[model samples]
Target chain A: MLARLARARTGGLAALVAVVALLPLALTNNYHYEVAIVVGLNAIVCVGLNLLIGYAGQISLGHAGFYGLGAYGSAILTVRYGWPPAAALVASTAGAAALAYLVGRPILKLRGHYLAMATLGMGIIISIVIATEDRVTGGPDGMAVAPFAVLGFTLAGERVWYWVIGAALALAVWLSLNLIDSPAGRALRALHGSEVAAQVAGVDPARYKVLAFVISAVFAAVAGSLTAYYAGFITPAKASFLHSIELVTMVVLGGLASTFGAVIGAAVLTTLPQVLTLLKDYEMMVFGAVLMLCMIYLPRGLVPTIADALARRRR
Target chain B: MSTFTLKHFTRAALAASLAFGAAAAMAQAPIKIGAFLSVTGPAAFLGDPEQKTLELYVERINAAGGVLGRKLQLVSYDSGGDAEKARTFAKRLIEQDAVDAIVGGSTTGETMAVVPLVEQAGVPFVSLAGAVVIIEPVKKWVFKTPHTDRMACEKIFVDMQARKISKIALISGSGGFDKSMRGQCLKVAPNYKIEVLADETYGGGDTDMTAQLTKIKNTAGVQAVLNAGFGQGPAIVTKNFRQIGLTVPLYQSHGVASKEFIKLAGPAAEGVRLPAAALLVAETLPDADPQKKVVVGYKRAYEERFKQDVSTFGGHAYDGLMLVVEAMKRAGTTDKAKVRDALEGIKGFMGTAGVVNMSPADHMGLDLTAFRMLEVKNGDWALVK
Candidate 1:
């Protein structure tokens, strides 16, 4: 069983890479490349978010706060102190992980909306601090971030960014899949199914929950760092409550406990607006209708519903 | 027989060539003007008018045999007052649509978000938002039409100086615009020799600012009070200021330069002062004034078409698009570089806002003279005389 699971995980990683590689071929212009890069960044964040929310039964309404911290941390370090971009990225991700560990330990003890409200407040407080601290964060106007570079090679243009973000997203999926197939992953899933049962079965719920929270926050932080470099600017809007809700919606809209579904969710939500924008004034209306229809017909989300149908047909 | 066939073939070839030339001239593409405004969010009041003004002017310009004899094509998107959306649309406008120039941005934050993209893309961006940072430490491609926060501060201080109100209080909303305005007021207060006795701030949605007002009311030697922000926040401050019975003359930033503010604040809006563009009081301007004709004409056309009172926010869009069109006319081509150069070279171009004179050193050529101090009287704007 372990060997087969390993083989399937490898297959999933390979499939993810193949899809990402083919995505740019469909893009004919610079704008498409730009949007595709955004999709990859959002997917990286959502994949990690799905790990906690889907597999561990944890809800984070303030994931954008971690994302913002990661972005602003890298930005302030590199722009102010002139730290190397790569070093800043690592340091910021570690910082976010540490923060999540501290906050998640206590917050994870709560269940349902109580957990949701705490996370929501956490995100708002981060946003307000970033906005109000004009001296460092450049206030609401936001400060510019240095272009991403490694060992004296500057990363430029949407085409280059697409590959970078794509690779990062693939890494995120691989990591999440591996984590899900491990002992800790099983522990999280057990807790999700029945906390009392899992606790009785010798699974330390608190330790695994905090570990999952740290991992998810690190994912968000990394994605945020990449976005800051790619967009050439950063703002407190990244940490706003609306952004946090959007991230949660992406995870829920995609099938729970599925690694690939998170990617699909991010890709669809990002690209849908760009495509529907051609509809002009009816853009939001159509977007809302599409979301409503998807939920109504495919309540289990796109991936799970389709997978369930395929399994039944095979039977 | 060979000579006759050769002659017929020559005639057919000439006719085909003429048809091709005619088709090519007829296909002279319209110059694309891209805009992204906050048309559907918290800042919708600003973007709605700005978008309408762009639409209204584009139709008018095309009707009058468009600039450089090519019809203007306005491609606009609603940013919804979000920076990420603004960046995406800014990129789309520049890269995908390949618009020759852009003339939109509703809030200071949205404009700032797109500044780097526009600068990097080398697209001439004429912002409709008011912020000193947009133009200062000047960017090569970005320009703005509205007066800066610094200029507004100077205008208010100059008015306060004339009234012999040596000591004043400052309370601002915590938004980006309010912060910058507050910063400018504090920065320039010492230069004007006016003392600020108290400084306080409230959130964008805070219902009551009485606590902040009460502090200012108790502060000694406080002769005037200035509230810096846009939307209902400023109105709430006004209501709270009056309710707390602070008799000091209340001042507001140009952010609330619309009648909606008066309606929101109701009777409390009475006697408040702020600096604004002459367009707000075009009908009252003397005939000898250069801005009178232009301002009045825009007011009539906009009100007749939209059935709403003209606003300075819309006037900013009007100025932005017209400036780009004028630059295009001067350049005589749709080339981005030439349009940008021509935009910088624009001198003394009279518009509804003010007599705009663009220079390399000064993107927003209007100084403190561009702002007119007005006091609210009987629920209406009256020029401060």
Candidate 2:
């Protein structure tokens, strides 16, 4: 176990799986299970977002728009066209990936705040389209999704959903870890260090950037689809700029380059709001305070800071 | 490990034991009414009052020896105007708190999100939202207090016919509430012999609605301009319409039936009319009117407690809670099915909104008569008559 811990990926995943397996013991009721499931879903999105922002050094301010498109795409196809839910999920994910490719091709060329603004504009456009196309999207009221089923088995109850979402989150983390270690991942990191330098080193900056953008979007779309099915409802709010900001916050607060940091960030931020509800009106105030304190003390983010502390202690 | 740690641990343990003792001593559980509202979100204005109303009534009911000789307990959560939060809270309310009934849902979206859960939980739910879909295709466990958008459109159209004004221009926000009202108006316009000259839409967050208002202004033969939306969007439109110098009688949907709209639009809101609950103009209502007494009483008590003006949204919560209480009293038990049955059978229950008459077919138990056509004059709501 000590040897495995030295190699973070295998140890971190084993710990995550162990936690997921044992979490139900502490979850006394459906509400706990429900909140846990939501945490997992958010973690899945943050994991992908980390790959884009942390690994590729690209910032996306409109990731929630892709998430919304995924949700609405699957919802519309299933609820309106009567396509099977599983098939619709795949189609919507592919659609979101395709959209990210088209939108990212030009916008990803820009860096820093320009890219942020462009993504923000893209999100606003998608939100407006979803809200205005009342005939298909059900306007701002949003439409209900049919029960999520694969084959003849239906997904129901918070307990069942918790496992499903947990597995998805685990898979997202695993895939992200594998990608970060691969040659393509090296290309992304190389460009992230210096675009001009990476080009001199024969890494196609635009190609890698767009690839990361599309892959991250696909992750968001899948997460969005799962959320829609889990919630049994989808609203334009899912794709709103607020959700996009929240996704970005989770990635940054977790730690840019750490995969496990993404999961920790998603878990803390998601669960914090639920716990903060005990404070009622002061919830937002305290939530802001916590974020500020976290940034001030552990600037590298929760997981990475803790890991750094552990390594130093061992030395 | 240290003397300081030992001292603090001892203090913590003492505190926990005292709390446990206090909780255990209160053996007889109060009858819990679970509520979730958009108390601190984009729709905080709606939920804040609804939550206050529930708190106010629960206190009053408990002071009056509670319902069915048991103290009334209100368990409330702020949904923050999100559907997912509302669902999670609803589940907690039912499974964990074991609330006897629920009276909440400040927004159309929140109510819809919890409808399925309330049905499955078999709890009596009286919603404060105005969406027709909440009560329509009626779910067995749910009822609502506010007048539906359909009724609001009918009331507005009736007033238009009375004035002999037919050609109207509709400008609405692209929201669920606005879209539903627009759809209802389009479906029912022909019944009132009204022709829609042009229909325009603006995004909810859009600050300048001058473009939509400009198109409406250019449409020939447009006798009345109706804005079907809630929040500041309609106020902006009203401001722009007046700024653009369109003299046509400006009408709004019930969604904007608040003093905030008048305040937001300022002088531009003058002469603008909409159908609203009788509560808004309760003081002006004649002594002989049935709703006047109920409305005035609630308005006075609520204002005194909260130290703020009463709103129609709060009044919806007032009516919903009282209706559920009345049904429980009629049923003589807190059993979910009995309360639901009694609620369905209730009739002539005078509420602040209107005289409610629930049935198996109609869960809302109110109609067009529940809404009053009111106009803004001198920055205040006044009866259209």
Q: Which structure among the candidates has the greatest DockQ?
A: 2
Candidate 1 per-residue lDDT over residues A32-118, each given as its tens digit: 888888888999999999998898888898999999999999999999999999999999999999888878888777665456677
Please state the Cα-based DockQ of model 2 relative to the true two-chain complex: 0.64
TM-score of chain A of each: 0.95, 0.96
What is the C-alpha local distance difference test score of candidate 2? 0.88
Off by over 4 Å in 2: A1-7, A110-113, B1-27, B163-175, B193-250, B260-272, B376-380
Identify the runs in model 1 with alpha carbons over 4 angstroms from their true place.
A1-7, B1-27, B202-220, B236-248, B264-268
lDDT of 2 by residue, A1-315 (tens): 432432478887888899899999999988889889988988989999998899888889899998998899999999999999999999999999998898888876765556677789999999989988989988766788998998899999888898999899889988988998899999999988988899899998778888888989999999999988988887788899999999989988988888888888898988898788788778899999999999999898877777777777788
Q: Please, what's the RMSD in Å of model 1?
A: 5.0
Clashes in model 1: which pairs?
none
Task: Report the lDDT tens digits of candidate 1 across residue range B1-385.
Answer: 9999999999997876677436465357678999999999778989999999999999999999998878999999998888888988998999888899999989888898899888888999999888788898889999999888888999999999999988998999877888888998899999999998899989888998888998888898899999889778999999988898988899998889888899999999999999989998899887998888888988899999999999888989999998999998899877789999999999988887788989999998787778999999999999998
